[model samples]
Target: MEPLVVAMLLLLLARGHSALGLGGRNMWLIKEKVLQAREQRARDHVRGGQRWSSAALGSAQHLEPQEEFFPQPLDHFNRQNNATYKQRYWVNTKLWEPQGGPVFLYIGGEGALTTYSVLAGEHVDLARKYRALLVAVEHRYYGASINPDGLNHRNLHFLSSQQALADLAMMHAFISHRYNLSKLNKWICFGGSYPGSLSAWFRLKFPHLVHAAVASSAPVRAQLDFTAYNKVVSRSLSNPVVGGSPECRATVGAAFGAVDEMLARGESAALERDFRSCRPLDGSGDYGQLAGNLADVVMGIVQYNHELGIDATIAHLCRLMANTRLGAPYRRLVALNANYMERMSLNCTDNSYQRALEELRSEVVKPYGVGERQWYYQTCAEFGYYQTCEDEGCPLSRWLTLRSEVDVCAQVFGISASSVQGAVDFTNDYYGADRPKASRIIFVNGDIDPWHALSVLRNQSRSELALVINGTAHCANMNPPETGDPLSLQHARQIIEEQIGDWLSRRPLYPL
Candidate 1:
């Protein structure tokens, strides 16, 4: 489902490690996670050591964006901190009209940037039609944007949506100057998942800069205990549109239930062996981690259910779960886990709580910190999008409670578990939750994607529209139109195209 989530984290360490790439979703900590190892490794190479170049990010012959960097301030709010860092950005003017052509900025999410963001997509196709300049600005903390000062909790204090927004504001100015853009050269921001939220917020906060926004699968609302997330995952399992059924959902629920029963029966050794836990179950935390890892398999599937129609799909998983020939529910879970791990190229599921604590405690920002620690820092500080499984009908084990997740925040960042709700409140207040008063922003979401539960699923106004495509997965419209795509998905893209054109043709619908 990595390919399914292709949320591709903005889950940062998709090839091997798992981070919150939305914190869990980027960290595709919140959104869909992309699953291909080759694609994930390509992003890692550019992020770890390799410099941004055409060769590093696929072929330019295939319309790969030319890698460029911006001298961004290390701290935008604190003028005293005059230090700066090179923020990565990519631009392609191959389709620019140079006269009244808009700038389509693809906002990079919680993970690293890939050539695919700029080279291919419905936005790129729109760029071709409107003769717009296509650009993608990498989020500061993620990818190669990591600063050398440190990755300590204190140092990471600056990594937040607020700072990322400021970065976008500055980049907007820089790009406008370089390209001679003006009010006539209206800018439309584009993003999916976490970056999708950024797109809508950019328009909300900086309406003077961006004329329109396309926020696909964006979870605009910040939630401390995202129990509803699992509820949607449970429902998605039985969604017949995407090839799901009630029997399948029940089997999935039963499988996790059996896991809990097996644990109670003192079958930790068997559990570890069957699920291939990297470390032996030692304590309550270890047990919870094991359950969490298994749950993520289902989460990834539902989040990006039918994306790419590749391996480890929800249908394939449901079949495995419901297959009577596979033996009991526990055995079915074991088989599903094996298939998912092999597909994800994971040698062993690292359900090590000790290692998790160590990594979060470590001051050193290694290659995979962007997906795990950096994103989690934001989760603890700003958006408490902690995916908990305490929901009534969640298919995951009960071990994955809200406290189990918030405990990490308290231990690592000194963010009290009690204060997480306050952080979430502040986020919702700042962004207006799902009721943002922004205009010309098309909030697109898929019914099957759990993240959509937090997004604007209904139209708030004539200008601030919402497009809820049925049977589609996370950010399905953002991808290039593929053969055999859902009709709703195809229709949503067409509407998005027409709406963007209308926004361009008319004068400011809302006050500038």
Candidate 2:
């Protein structure tokens, strides 16, 4: 594999955050940043599960997982179309009891899955305790499950959260029948971020298929104008708990404000040189891409705040932005962006609109965007979690507006901006958004994770409990209990385990 692919693989292993289909990533760079994680599993095995330099922090423990595939129907909702596609999956029976064990199904999101996905992380730990059968199904249109008909508008019509949930239900039957699973063996589903939403939806849609669900940093609400996303990012940047301060957030806003001034002044040449843009920022779209990439650096740091792999923590970024010797706020942003690019092994940051369009418009999977294109289609059709900056207290440029983002929907998929709102409403109406009338689901979110703004933070009901960790970021509870973990995160995980135990034991989480 190329160094670029390897470098990108490291980011994908983070697992909780999204390269596409989330608030922070809705309008972010689609080119170099879209290194879909399909290849990470193979690379990790070659390097022996330790390719990630940071903590391997949340990686699974199972080694030598048995890989398999099931011929899943392409259009699960279409009863007539019997055309099936081979869906890749992995099973680890290391901890399963010979007599009977619970099935811990790891639902893949917008990307591929590695054996590490099935073997590692918090769910695997639970699987061990419960002696559960560990199985992971790659989401349709991602990794080896990409539909053979291609990603055209017509083919992608079948790709929706509704259909994906059906895929999960079908997989449950396939795996249960294959394992000879009986009613004694209950199913517990797990996922984070977009997959996290899937986990919640799976329980909501098919209560019989899954007994319980643990959704981490799951954005259950779908909205077109996700301005609240950056609003939360702004707050997180000011959170002193994670090394953020008023000055840090102020500096970010000032930096983007200065960049906007430069762009308005038509000083594209100097701006490109300062930010190390690979191409000239000639048009409005390229300029918007530049703004989006700069904002992406801050958004990613905040979303993955204090996570193991990301070297550039909020503290590191704030320190760079605070250095007065860096000159102005734009200069400080330049320094920070420089560090982020270097961390990702990127030589020159491409801020070309046409280049991004080429990636989004392509039918075949590109090396860079293995699933981003597919994810973009989903956002256009179903969920419009576009992280725009037009809202108040936004630290990024105003040019990264809902209009600019919805334009991608129009340009590539011909999805009108007006239609986007309808799709988002449909998603929320269908799944019940954050307040979905579902039982036996524990929705987990970290205060610092912007996606939390859309999750179930408060206790909606006893059965549908919400656990929000005070001093943590995206999917913090989903990682194994570490020494440096905050007390709140530790407690949150305990509550999750308790809930799972109750669900399995048939104990009512709430009394009537």
Please report the candidate that would top lDDT against the real structure: 1
Q: What is the lDDT of residue 220 in candidate 2?
A: 93
**Per-residue lDDT tens digits of candidate 1, residues 350-373?**
777777777777766443323567
Residue-level lDDT tens digits of model 2 in 225-322: 88888999999889898888999999999988887666555578988898888878756667667777788888888887655244557878888889
TM-score of 1: 0.88
lDDT per model vs. reference = 0.77, 0.76
lDDT of 2 at 500: 92
